[model samples]
Target: MKTITLIRHAKSSWEYDVSDIDRPLSTRGENDANLLSKKFIEYSFAPDAIFSSPANRALTTCNIFIDNLNVSKKLLSVDEKLYDFGGHQVAKFINNLSDQYNKVMIFGHNHAFTAIANSCGSTYIDNVPTCGLVMIEFEVDYWADVKKGITKMTIFPRDLKD
Candidate 1:
């Protein structure tokens, strides 16, 4: 089985006069990332590989999960393709993923993430909000052959808010 988890970057701060890629996560975003990471660990879902957009907001959210899960930094990689927002590049990236890693996690932007979840997952997701996660499991053994698959789980920051 090929399992792919897509996570949208946490809410970013626009206070700084910087490029979109350089904008950092807001305080609420940090809290949400930490909360969601811990909540994900409770489900015992671990990815064999982690990929993230180089954007500061996205990378920072990915790092929070890595730190909370105690996963080795070696398993994490920065892929520029994930920086895409239109979903084309993200879709292409997922389709061409290495087959060696059955379970993969990607952190990026959306509507790309939302589009991927809707296109590749069995369940219909209206939107993949900031720090939201969606896991889909494809029956196909090869990543290239992955089509529509079961939506295993979804985690959103709002769902955990007390």
Candidate 2:
């Protein structure tokens, strides 16, 4: 079996006159990242590999989760391909993932994340909000063969807000 977890980058700040890829997370984004990461730790779900978009916002959110979840920094890698907003590149990246890793986590942008989740997961999600997480489990043994799978879990910052 193979499992893929997708996380959308936290809300980014537009106040900075920087490129989209260089934009940092907003204050609310940091808080949400912290809140969600802490709550996610309770689930005790660990990924064999973690990949993130090279974009600043996505990488920052990934770092927050890694620190809070106590996941090894070694498991993390930045991939320029994950910066894709469209689902095609993201899907191709996932499909080409090494079969050695059964469970993997990815941090990236949306439209791509949401699109991929809706296409592959049994559950239909209108959107995957900032810092949102969706985990899909496939029956296939190989990553290349993963098509439709069960939506095992979803964690969103809004749901955790008190």
Candidate 3:
């Protein structure tokens, strides 16, 4: 089985004068990312590799979670395609992942994230909130075998608040 953890980039700081791609996460986003990382550990879900959007907000979110977990930084890769908001682009990126990575985490933007989750038969409301995570398990043997209607689980940040 292959596990795909889709994490929407945490809340970004709108006060920044920089472009959207360079906007950093807000203070709340930093805290939420850390909190969610701990929750993932409590649930015993750890990714073998991480694919993050090149955007600063997403990268910051990824760094927060990885730092909170004390995970090695060597396993993370910044992918440009993750910056795209189209689910098909994200799907193609996932399909091309090296076979060695069975369980992976992706830190990216919303719309596409939620769209991909829905495409996998998982019901999610609107956008995936900042710091929200949806864990989808596919029974397929390889990443390339992943497809729509294969989702086995979906967990949101709000659901973990309780």
Candidate 4:
């Protein structure tokens, strides 16, 4: 069995006059990401590999999760292909993931993340918001054979609010 978890980047700061790829996380994003990281352990979300978009906000979010999980930096990679917002490139990249890593996590943007969750997982998600996490389970032996699987869980920042 293989599992893949998708995490949408945390809220970004528009305060800086920077390119979309260079935008940093907002204060809310930082705190929200930290909160989500604790939830990850609570949910027992320990993956074999963690991939993130090269974009700043996404990378920052991934880093926070990595830190909280105590995941080695060696297991994390920044893939430009994951920067895709259209869902096609991201989908293609996931479909071609190496078989060596059976359980994986990807930090990226939407509508790609939302689209991926809907298409690759049996559950339907209308949107994947900032700091959102969705876990999917696949019965395939290899990622290349991936198709629709089970939507095991989903956690959003709003769901944590008092």
Best by lDDT: 2
Per-model lDDT? 0.93, 0.95, 0.83, 0.93
Off by over 4 Å in 3: 149-155, 160-162
List the lowest-lDDT window of 10 residues for candidate 1: 39-48
lDDT of 1 by residue, 10-31 (tens): 9999899999999999999999
Best by TM-score: 2
* lDDT (Cα, tens digit) per residue for candidate 2, span 59-150: 99999999999999999989999999999999999999999999999999999999999999999999999999999999998889988999
Off by over 4 Å in 4: none
Clash counts for the predictions, in order: 0, 0, 0, 0
lDDT: which is higher, 1 or 3? 1
Ranking of models by lDDT = 2, 1, 4, 3
Tens-digit lDDT string for candidate 3 (47-119): 7999899999999999988887777899899999999787788989988888888889999987889888887
| lDDT for position 36 in model 2 | 92
For candidate 4, write residues 1-162 as lDDT tens digits: 899999999999999999999999999999999999888888766688999999999999999999998878899989999999989988888888989888999999999999999999888889999999999999999887888899999999999999
Runs in model 1 with CA error above 4 Å? none
Runs of candidate 2 exceeding 4 Å displacement: none
Collision count of model 4:
0
Q: After superposition, how far is residue 44 of candidate 2 from its true place, in Å?
A: 0.8
* Model 2 lDDT at residue 160: 93
